[model samples]
Target: MTTMFRYPVFPVLPGLGQTDIPEGLSRVRSIMAEPDYMDGDSDELIKPKKLLNPVKSSRNHQDLHRELLMNQKRGLAPQNKPELQKVMEKRKRDQVLKAQKEEQEAHKKRSDLEIELMKRRETLEQLELDQHKDDEEQENTPEFVKMKSNLRRTKQEVDGQERST
Candidate 1:
């Protein structure tokens, strides 16, 4: 003998594969839809939610940090300065201007020094060339030796006078 119930108050989905449901959801949904279902605790029905963009929230926090730092340096919020603040600003500006002028003067002095060094280098090179030419011309000339001796004596006398003064 077979016993059949007239109406299943909540339908019992047959173990799956005998229905119109999609393959993926067939097993899970069937179990869930069971009338006498007690799979586990009731709370497990809902999925554990998560944020899609954690960095987006961090980006907002970064904006707050930037605002805080900016406010700290430039008085509160909108850059409004009191009378003393204005005076301090003017003082700072004056100091910066003075520093810039000093820097310009230093640069000018450096350029002048470089120019003087170049000129001295050129003069030294010219003197070396002249001495080399004189040496070449003196190979057979006796007067060249006499002239060199006189020049050496003159240089020594001038150095002696400078040292004394």
Candidate 2:
């Protein structure tokens, strides 16, 4: 029995107007002239010179240098995983603190909004009370004589019934 693992390798090609290259790969050659789209037959042909350029390696070296500097600063005595863990822990703690601060600010905003709503409600209640008073005064005016006469008639009916009883 044979166990075989075959991984599909997909070549990332450049778009219509540009050449496809890895993220850090720098093309020293000017892209003034565009290459013709290679047909299926020409796809198998590998140009050694084109593949030999280490533009990506140059970028990786820079990233490696940066990592080295960070390690030096943290005094990561080579292969010591504890220091890396400490750095990661510190980062997590910082993120948590930042999130907590944001939450506190959100809470404060909600409280301020609640206070404003309460104040508006009080103002609306006062306005309603003032409007009610105005309505009462209007009802008492001379033009409201019909309503006053109706009330007197009802009172007379009640008094006459009481005397008869």
Candidate 3:
């Protein structure tokens, strides 16, 4: 069944298609050229579309692509923001902080006064209670209030009296 190995190994004949090597290569057998697509038993036609034609990149192309990617993180920007930032830096370097501190102190004082006023303001219920508790207005006249404040005894005199008692 095997064609290559037979009962008797066929001797090389010079009359065949294969040619003998020259005198220098007495033991060497005949050589063969590389097999071609046209020589194969398969009769399939070549398909150019199925063939691969990949593009190869050199070092320069790869380096250019890497640089492009590295630089594309952001686009070009106007210089206005940098100028404004410089202005802000100048403001920080100037006495703007002192002015801001003064404004903050004034704001704190105003807020404290507002809180005191809110505490002094009477609610509707308190107002009604005051109205009903005394139908007649009390000794709340401005002159009477001023007289009471002026005639009020000194704290030292009151303390001496308490000690004597």
Candidate 4:
């Protein structure tokens, strides 16, 4: 799409005349024409390359080379295990895992036994409490109260006879 540039036109009321600059106004330079914004020297534009310490790097490489050579002398070889070694390692790992599983099972059984004993103790305590309440209820019955009163009367009568004698 093309755009049509439109500018405002002036009538008699808008017929503006040339006006002089304001009393305090002065012409100023633009930032684009300043020296700082212009192209610089090629030498200044291209940065200098960084220097590296090749001697230190070579020393590190030499030390690593010597260490590898000494490791070969010390019989500290890299691991490329034979089939028999691999099989032995696998069996060792399996044994360790089986032992761990057995330990977990034993711990589970012990915890289960503890839980069962705790429940049994709670049930026994509840039964004893129920028995105590039943005994209290029985004592509160009319027959038990009458029996208790009769025993008290008989004891008093015996004491009175003994005193008279």
The most accurate candidate by lDDT is: 1
Scored by TM-score, the top model is: 4
As a TM-score, model 4 comes out at 0.22
Candidate 4 per-residue C-alpha lDDT over 76-129 given as tens digits, one digit per residue, 9 for 90 to 100: 985588779999999999999999999899777787778899899999999999
Ranking by TM-score: 4, 2, 1, 3
Q: How far is 62's C-alpha from truth in model 1 (Å)?
A: 62
Give per-residue CA lDDT, model 1, range 28-133, as digits (tens). Answer: 5745656433555576466558867666568887797789788889887754667799999999999999999998997777777788998999999999999999
TM-score of each: 0.20, 0.21, 0.15, 0.22
Worst 10 residues of 4 by lDDT: 23-32
* Comparison by TM-score, 2 against 3, better one: 2
lDDT by residue for model 2 over 103-153, one digit each (tens)?
899777777778899899999999999999989987777856867888999
Per-residue lDDT tens digits of candidate 3, residues 1-165? 866854433346667533444435434333344445656665685634654434335677777667766666665333446677898898886778888889899777777778777667756668888887665544444677666665675666788899999
After TM-score superposition, what is the CA distance of residue 151 in candidate 4 from its true location, in Å?
Answer: 15
For every candidate in turn, the CA RMSD to the true structure comes to: 20.6, 21.4, 26.0, 18.4
Each candidate: what lDDT?
Answer: 0.77, 0.75, 0.63, 0.74
How should the candidates be ordered by lDDT, best one leading? 1, 2, 4, 3
Off by over 4 Å in 3: 1-43, 49-56, 74-165
